[model samples]
Target: MSNKKPILAITMGDPAGIGPEIAVKAFSDSAVYNLCRPLLIGSAAIMSRIVKELNSRLKVNSINNVTEAGFQFGEIDVFNLEIHNPEDIKYGQISSTAGDIAFRSVVKAIELAKNGEVDGTVTNPINKKAINNAGHHFSGHTEIYAHYTNTPKYAMLLADEKLKVIHVSTHVSLRKACDLVQKERILDVVQILNEGLKKLGINSPRIGVAGLNPHAGDEGLFGDEEIKEIIPAVKEANERGFIVEGPIPPDTLYALAAGGKFDGCVAMYHDQGHIPFKLMGFVWDDDIGKMKSVKGVNITLGLPIIRTSVDHGTAFEIAGKGIASPEALLYAINYAVKLYNN
Candidate 1:
């Protein structure tokens, strides 16, 4: 294993959103500098403008490759793609220009990682509609990565302090999510969740699988997914020497997981996992009319390269406010460091 500090490439997500703001904000933290040698895979001019508008004291240094990055505190290095003009993008508005820039940055970061130029990637939020408008048809980061890497099996893992949840199906409708609750898929999710948790430093993870129906199907009264699918999946995982408990009631499973009853939870769908994880990570300060802190990392497991991102979205309403929280981005960088070291 390389003992040198890991080099991380951060993709500046939709320039029109909070991506630029938070990227600048996160670099302002000295801790980030100490954790990894970070580079921005976006525009230097736009980042400079954001630094000046936000009145941040950081300096933007444009470089052609990772070797040129200063990786020094108070100075940020950007691998400028020069894909979009700052004047072409409007803050908080969805446009094809912003979409193109965002999509290109991600592609650049992935290329750098695949070529071994960077250790991993830490992405900010990008607008799905805008990306689609730009002609890159994909649901979310996980799909884009899977496509680029030619990976068929991948899952979204949202991690905070005590609560860790992995989605069996994400970026799909509730009806489609239910339709995806097959025994093979459930078993795959369990294996992926367990391996992902272990990568995050958990040894011998105890996974809790949630039931697809009310009260775990009430023993076939409401549904039998538990008996027919979920239970069998859990049994197979256990027989393979995994410490897993599941087909539990969704209502109580999350509560117990949050309290540290389990190392990780396998949610049946997107909302089943996101709502609980967001409830714990997102804090709203009504008095201040902004988030107190956004504190979760969205990690894509079973990818060819390491990828971690902020669990929040593009808060278009607060794009250039300079108050967007970088807590989540910071955590993501730290998590990437952990994974690299492991």
Candidate 2:
């Protein structure tokens, strides 16, 4: 009742996916309501259907604006865009209607954050092909936020219980990702990660920079990227008084980082970071054919507005099964709240 907590605008990702269901599940947790005021930015009709389908005790309060949100548990305040009729969406299938609604919800959340109407934004997963089919051509959530916020320098920071990894180049081809590894870009990501760690309550972060090649280029035998680009970047970061160490072999760096060796890590590409992080955080239940716990928060660093998202993609295979874990979304919302408070 203090009215001091941040108000978060939670976007409904691809309507055909588990976005709506997870939003419902995440809000059902009373902890989320106690920490921050949540405003769901998507179709009220879709959420209403999802609530009924899930047989949840919660109800949806369709509001026209942020000011109308009640911020109450058992009643979700939706900033209804009304972009899709629940009848138009088919579970486990991608359609242009779902894509359009997903895109619109994200754009609206960004606008609210930029205008100071909300403290931060929490996004669920959106299918890339679906959004492209709807004519909004963007690779993923990070790219969309970067373009809309006009943020030139941004890195995707993925964090779970102990491991944290930031990417230098994401949503690009392997060839292009290699070409993107430069000293300046590496340094930039390290700087962003350092600042991000401080926000996460690390007083002094020891950062690790991963090498692009195996065995850190075998001392320039396998490749010279470490000596040419990575070493210089690490040297500069160290000289700048950042507790940084790097040019470590990617094969072993993540293992050490996960064991509490480093505060965070910087990777050369998307999969380099994601593969290891997901391996650690994601748990699949083969018997149920769904995730038991999707446990990572994808935070966009260097953005003017705070934005965090579920690290996992839209689980289209089990969209309406009522079993898609909302753990990742809960983590994302909590992270957004943490960053906003920071």
Candidate 3:
């Protein structure tokens, strides 16, 4: 029993997506094993196909239990879910079968983490439509984590080297997103963000809250959300001893945070935070018409078990191309280890 390495369960998101590819690429990097013992929880057949497709030299050691895994440095350890065949594993396609398999893998990972079978679970990307098509009815990973862990309060934290963002409402429409920003919800998210940063080793995290409307409603000209809900939330959070500042203009807050002025920012909606985070983390090469680097980790805070995932999605178009970037998955696994250590 090597106590130096934390046991991490990595789930292959959807066979139809780039999940298998990135999971293989992430573990193939020898540096990953140095931080934690990673055990992939997905189908062996799918992984085998991916290994051959990518021409990766690493071998897959299939196991039924976490303890059964070899945890070898160069070899990839997979807990075979045995859900799909190679013939059924078509890339860039959406099917209920794939959805069911992806959902089940996540469920199994959650069960293992809750039971302490693994220290944490880091997930690859999964399409919400696919998961819903399989009758799982999940909006995204955060909701799945919340349901399985029975956690009432949780926030989606997107992190990179320069900036960290926690969203108040995600996977909701822009109109509904604004409506959901009440004082209580704002305060709850703020508290979660503060606590999450502390766990990430920040002793005193300086948090900036983004406004809900354009120019923060221009002092009630654009919208009243900032004045009514956002400001009150910041005020209440401060009263509770949280080092919080906000209702700042959404467009400007992210830039300030990315510039290292603030430790993290609370985004009002999905795109408000996602765009800025991706702008900083994802690099594209226009001449090559491809992404040079895709970095960032999506962490669901307030769950009973630690859950981190790639901030990107299931790129069905490039699923089996062996070109998908594993940087995000690698970062997510590393972030999970950091959280576990903290």
Candidate 4:
């Protein structure tokens, strides 16, 4: 393996969303250059337009391959995909063309990582509706990554600072999500979380599993998922020599995890995991009527290749306004580097 700095392939998400804006802004930061060689895999025309729209002074160099990238300070190297028309790039509008481009960028990034052209990938937020409109038929980034890479046992891990969470099920309806929770799935997620935490430098990480029902089914009064599925999984994990806890109450597990009681928490479904993670990472300013800061990194575990992404989505309304926060992407990039190093 190469001992040099890890090369990260950043995919520019939906052209109509904040993906392009943030990509331009992220490379403008001098600190990003210091960590690793960042190469953008997206439309060069759209990126150039964003740089101009944002009034950024940084220069963007279009390259055909990773070796051709300059990786120099004050310069952004973009591998031109040429998938979008400069005139067709409209903010806050969804089009099949834009969706196809976004899907292609992700596919290319996975291909690069699988081929060892890059160490890992950090993806911008993609619009699910748009991607589906383009006939790609992916539910989200995790699904797409899993499909293209043929990874069968993948899970989504959300990280911000010390708090890390892995989900048992995501992108499914509430009814289906509840039914999908089982001992096998829960155990798989726990194992993935334990392995991931270790890679993040946590030795013998403590994992807390959240119950699927309200108030942990009140000990079978509210639901039996905790007793039937969650508890069994936790017991199995503990028997395997993992420091695992729970079938804990969902309401309080997040608080305990946030309080640093555990290294990571295993959530039952999408909202159960996303709500608490976002609440901690997203800071809303009521006076400004907007988010003050958006944080967190979404990592897809069990893939053949390493993939991390901004924990938020495409903010189409702020696509060209130059106000998009690149903090999440920065965090994702940093985490991707750490994962690569490990």
**Best candidate (score: lDDT):** 2
lDDT accuracy of residue 273 in candidate 3: 88
TM-score of each candidate structure, all chains considered together: 0.98, 0.97, 0.97, 0.97
Give me the displacement of residue 75 in model 3, in angstroms.
2.0
Candidate 3: clashing pairs of residues: none
- Predicted candidate 3, C-alpha RMSD: 1.7
RMSD vs true structure, all candidates: 1.1, 1.6, 1.7, 1.3
In terms of lDDT, which candidate is stronger, 3 or 4?
4
List model 1 lDDT by residue over 1-342, tens digit each.
458889999999998899989899889988888888999999898889999999989999999888999899999899987864569788899988888889889988999999999999999999999999999999888998999989999999999888999989999999998889988998898888888888888889999999999998999999888888899999999998899998899989989998889999999999989998898888899999999988999999989899999999889998887788888999999999988887
lDDT, candidate 2, 1-342, per-residue tens: 134799999999998999999999999999998889999999998889899999999989999988888898999999989774557779888888899999999999999999999999999989899899999999999999999999999999999879999999999999999889999999999999999999888889999999999898999999898999999999999999898898999999999999999999999999999999999998888897666778999999999999999998888888888888888999999888888777
Tens digit of per-residue lDDT, candidate 4, span 1-342:
245788999999998999988888889898888888999998888788888888889788998888899999787888889774557657899888889899999999999999999999999999999889989998999999999999899899999886799999999999999999999999999998988988888888999999888888888999898889888889989999999989889899999999999999999999999999999999988897667999999999988788999999898766767778899999999999888878
- lDDT for each of the candidates? 0.90, 0.92, 0.88, 0.90
Worst 10 residues of 1 by lDDT: 81-90
Sort every candidate by lDDT, greatest first: 2, 1, 4, 3
Return the TM-score for candidate 3, rounded to 2 decimals: 0.97
Better of 2 and 4 by lDDT: 2
Ten contiguous residues with the weakest lDDT in model 2? 82-91
